[model samples]
Target: MKTRFWLSHLRRVSPMIGLAMMVLAACAAPGREAPTTPPTPNPTLTVSGGGALQPSPVPPTAAFPAATPTLPPPPGGFGSPACENPYLPVRLGATWDYQLIHETTDTFTRSVIEVTADGFVDQDEFAAGAVRQGRWQCQDGNLIYLTPGPVAGSVFAGEMQTDVTLESNEGFYHPADLRPGQTWHQKTVFRGQSTLEGEIVVETRTEVNYACRAEDFETITVPAGTFDALRVTCEVHFTTSVAEGMTFEIEEQSTQWLARGVGMVKSVGQTEGAPPYTIELLSYRLP
Candidate 1:
């Protein structure tokens, strides 16, 4: 009877020992995951400008600032003091010299010879021995160019040998009629014919179209002193045709500053596929 009681006690203790061994095996498993620690938060940075600490605003990763707009001059703000048309003073015997800034340095001069009912006759000479004669006129308060006629004893008289003529005329500036934001149009045509070997003949024609706008009034400085000037922007389209079945087209943009009584003080020109060039007044003489 004592042996039977001891066997029953051993059977109950064997089940408890099996459960404790299973628990120990689960805790000692090789693939079990470890507990993770929480991450710490970062503190914000503040900038001090001699005041209380304040969080700085985040800057944009990629952005550009907007351009500032230029203000226009007031009405009747700046102009030539002595002339009715301030942008162009059509005084006879007046002259101006300009420096051309391009690949090579050059000089250009324009001189007025005679005053007509409409405008004045002028001559433009370049340091490279090129010469152009033209007439400038005021039509309805707008400055215009006319097909130059023969002058009795001028350099234009020599041009008669070349058989070149101005087929059409155009106006470049209309300062009297233009207010800020106003625009105007101009068209000019030139035709020429030359004979080679007394038999071969060559004919050529050139047409230029200009769209000009009175952009704004601003103070500009150049080799000369600073001046309050009217700014004009122009888009120029030029086409040329040859009788030999060849034709081509060109486009350029230019900006000009005209001060009162000073004509063109500065000009900047840019053509497609070419470097930009500028012409600025060095000195001027006016009657």
Candidate 2:
């Protein structure tokens, strides 16, 4: 009876649970999608002294003291003006600090280092002492994660050390050309291998499916400030298979608030049988 009850509950909440986990994982290391054809590299702009182009900083507006509750999908749907993606600041030297609350409270930071001839590089540091060095690029007005690898001397989770290599660039945000009710899909696969105490090797394959939509607009207040933001909802399905024939599946729902020029100010994720998790921007420095 207990197994039957849990199964029934999972059937109803799988999508939401999957999305919650996906949002957290993706934020840490955005994966790559499988593309049928190779895409041409976008033109790179050079800055003064023949350096990489830098993003211009945008000033923040007045803050709203009152926190607005989440609202239903907006009527008539809204699209970004000029089809510009605002979720990624993309400026060199820009940084954002976030406070994540899950089983425990932790802080994380993401900083943009170099805007290369092909893409940009970011350094991600987790409170648990792990760090990820990655690259990102813009294509079709969407921000994509190109390649992500762990830095040497960076601390890793658990007793295993793992590395992530991108097979293809995966879209992380599509604020440009996004309209209310517009749905998009993404799939990513990652392979992880770890060596145990002796010489035993364990391989794990992770696959994630995301179905996201531009749902509405809302006012969210964080430690940084309050702003009117675009709300995006996603349903995610995740599967992990181990070399030992053990497979785990997860489902969740996630919501992110992207403020213009500020990026992600807040995200809420929830899964069944577990407490909800949240990440909120504490502060940020642009350019």
| Tens-digit lDDT string for candidate 1 (156-217) | 11111223445545444354534566667666555543332332233445566667777778
Model 1: per-residue Cα lDDT at residue 42: 31
Candidate 2 clashing pairs? 16-252, 16-253, 17-251, 17-252, 18-251, 18-252, 19-252
lDDT, candidate 2, equals 0.51
Model 1: weakest 10-residue lDDT segment is 1-10
lDDT of 1: 0.51
Worst 10 residues of 2 by lDDT: 1-10
Error of 2 at 34 (Å): 28
